[model samples]
Target: MDFRKLLLVDDEEGVRRFLGLSLMDLGYEVKTASNGREALAVFEEFQPNIVFTDIKMPVMDGIELLRIIKEKSPDTEVVMITGHGDLDLAIESLKFDASDFITKPINNDVLEVSLERARERFTMKCALREHTENLERLVEEKTSRIVELERQNAACQVVNGLSSALESASREVETGSGLFNELPCLVSIHNRYLEIVAHNTLFEERLGNHVGDNSFDIYSDRTSPGNACPVQRTFQTGKGQRSRETFLGKDGEEIPVTVYTAPIPNKDGEIELVLDISVDMSEVTRLKDELFATRYKYQRLFDEAPCYITVQDADLAIVEANRLFKRDFGEVEGHFCFEAYKHRSEPCEGCLVDKTLLDGEARQRETVVTTLSGERKHMLVQSAPLHDASGRVIQAMELSTDITEIRRLQDHLTSLGIMLGSMSHGVKGMLTSLDGGIYRLESGLKKGDAERVDAATKTLKAMIGRVKKMVLDILYYAKSRELETEAVDAAAFLRETAAVGAAKAASAGVEFVEDVPEGLGEIKADTAALSAALVNFLENGVDACEGRGADGGGRLSLSARREGDNLVVTIADNGMGMDRETREKIFTLFFSSKGKRGTGIGLFISNQTIEQHGGAIAVDSAPHKGTTFTITLPRGPAR
Candidate 1:
């Protein structure tokens, strides 16, 4: 139970404190003091519900303390403590409005009864205070609503009778009389007969008076043909309306203005007059034109920017794309940014655009893109956040710089470096052969030995042919290429490839030959590409055969035949074959096994050409067991 508080006071500590325990037992929070002066100080700070003070205490007796407390807080009930048989003091305390008398041989029963009475009164006082505050808050809310209603009604009254000054002297609005003259606006009022009864001084100064003329005739005569007169329409609809109108002023100048009309009702709640207010809108119209000019200026800049710019919404959908972005990405609006720019079914992993929106921070990433029309581009993408008023990201702006050509040039340079590394030894060996041939030819010319001269010439011719093939391979890898195909006899094609490989194989003392079936059918192929691809395979086989030791006895051969719907060509070499690692990476571009004698891109480019002809190539090789490369091509239309 929550307790009410009690204060006990007497000259002797024994009686006052002894009374405190009794009051506490009766469920009162008790504070005890030795005298009335001490009791008054405790009461001021504690604000106990009941104070019991003795009339004969030494400092400022009970009667005077009771008077002071009742004056300061009339609700705090004070009780007097009297000695046994001290009837007169108790009766005197009652005059000061003391709550109840307690005899100080301090009876516990009397204290309990007195304290309970004070608690009842305190609880009632608290309830009344809360009720009063609630009532005041409700009154304030109602007053605010009523004030807003009155303000709206006052505006309606002023707008309905704005130009009543010339109607009837008694019909003029009292409050708006001074406002009407001070405001700079066009104002007119017409009676139910549709005849103009009044006009503002400003209106009269600019458009002339129309005191007895009809409203429709006043505007219709000056109106640009088809537009309805705003004032006449108000009478027809019996409701207010607004429209833009241009008038021929008294000065003979066209003045553009926006007209507002309101219906005025009399005591019978029927339409009585139509009030027209027109405001000159020439300045607003000029500002709107300027705004459009500014937007047009920036729009031109955005469209013609050198870099690609795209505006994306919160969902990462491309909402707007500038001219450059549209030109490169091909009409990306209404598509998700990743789908439009990256051609991805889902968003790109670790997409910086998504990160920028989530954190409201700008981000940048470099990416490779294949466009809608199959052009590949490399872009440096920069995404920045566009935020709303509360600092939440609403959209993201991406600016992409095209680095496609630059990236292509870099790839070309890298391929060139790998090419130089792969073929340096081959070129060096060929140069040595050319130097020896020239030395032998010069020696033969001095000694008159035609046999030595002719042999040197053959060696030089063979080295030149091999070096020229390497140069062609380099040229093919350097550019974007297309195939030139023609119908050719399969046997004739195999014979050509063998003739080219025979010279290189002879230099290494290996047997190089082709086994094409006599009745092989004609096939459609890019002859140059097909020959180049077949030469690469034959050269690799010869090179593998030469890698064997002098006593190992090497052989390289090519065999071709038709198998079902495919042309199967197999090149085999009985020499040093490849291990598992080399076989796996044999066709990988820039991967070489011949130290400095192999151009790693030769096999790679060959595989690409064969695949373009709707073909596939497979390699079977094992260490010291020799290697076989099989090429399969469909005997169908070219890719």
Candidate 2:
């Protein structure tokens, strides 16, 4: 691989030289800039693959430097160094897709880790860009040839047939990019038995075209598709379906997509093949919202919805107001939700709608509303999060049902739906993993290949064992299954956990470590539940490590020891750690930092399971700093 072309931007000469040398020590070809203005000048000539800049600088600040560099060379990874007080500004830099950031007075380890992550991002960006360029060129060449052939034949049908033949040939050029793969969406075709038949560019790059992986598993977010996956729903119902869904991308980021699936039925009206299509709606959502705001401004029920309905964004800027909302609250469009509804210049205290935006979940509360007629009415309000195609909450729809007339009222109740969603994500992964092994085993069996079958068998056994454990845990929690607490050796337990996670880490090019003193004393614990809890922690850490960056081997470790009468276990990783906001709700149901990649159940389940064992989970983390999760369990046996 070519050396990473790096650029350093800082007003202070010592700061630039110091950081520049540090990168050079890591085998990078470094370039230095005195300020953002100089950095831009060097950038045009040096074309740096990665950049490190101080947030504060002369002529141009790091944020401006980031904006310019991205506007021009978006593929270049930029890392910012900011002070503690500039934390919020640094976060805003990330919105511009900054690779990573570090605090001022940076620790060498943290800086190195940040650079390593930037390296990984740079690699992926280059690969995707190259793949796209190659595809475009190939399409052009083939298209020109087809045009030449069409000119030689004046027959329209012949030209059309030849043109289509070119497309078919183009589709067969490679598994990653198809003739139509350049289209603004992920497209694929699958056969019966859930096997992927073919796929396009974005599909292959984002989600590998692993030939035999089950479609249900590949497309589903959680253990089960749960009616959210268009492909699964279509296959089951033998009908076309369109909806929104989230898929995990390369590096484990969540990709929100709008999906459409249709079945290609045989002559007897029997489905033999299915077509899957998904589009990234980030660039299109604003247009969609605009269209909805105009076209549906007077939607049929807007004048008739029994409740007050309001649509607003994060700033509480009212996007649209229903007829009832208008009459009761006065023409509120183009005004703040709070100003219109509560007559307050600032947002209402404990704003439930605002909370929905923060975590991308629904919120409900009973509030008293005053009408223009000077009457107070009791209303049960529900604010549902409206997410963009990328799964980030962008807006919310508030619906308030009037309950003033009712003499008796029931308490609002919410189910643990997030738990079920997360379980489905886990199940989805296990299904595909086991399917891959099964495919290899079956293929080997047909060819009378013992070695292949033997290897596949091992894989199948391990994956199936994991699935069985998860199933048992769910069943036990449901009812009737016996729970047995036993004396488990600390070293052996941690070693096994490390072993379970090693393969995953290796696959992602991450380093997995286990450190537990031999003969570290046994602890009384519910073997299954505790094991499941710890494994969840391990898996999450592994995932975060991968997302942070596999460059320089993303590090994850498991360590355990006995603390007096308490057994303490720690799972730590130098991965994309959480911000304070993210950390606060990680234990909440459906709270996922991984976007669509997380079902938000792992930490929640881990917390619940640990608490059940008379234990507590503590966390130490910051964005890009890494996270350490410590689990403290009582040493005594069952009561």
Q: Highest TM-score, which number?
A: 1
Q: Which digits, one per residue and each the tens of the lDDT, describe model 1 over residues 201-283?
A: 77777777667876754552443323447766777797889988876576766678888888776644466877777887777
**Where is the poorest 10-residue window by lDDT in model 2?**
407-416
lDDT of 2 by residue, 230-279 (tens): 66667789888888777767667777788887676654456666777778
Instruction: Give the TM-score of each candidate.
Output: 0.55, 0.30
Q: How far off is residue 350 in model 2, in Å?
A: 22
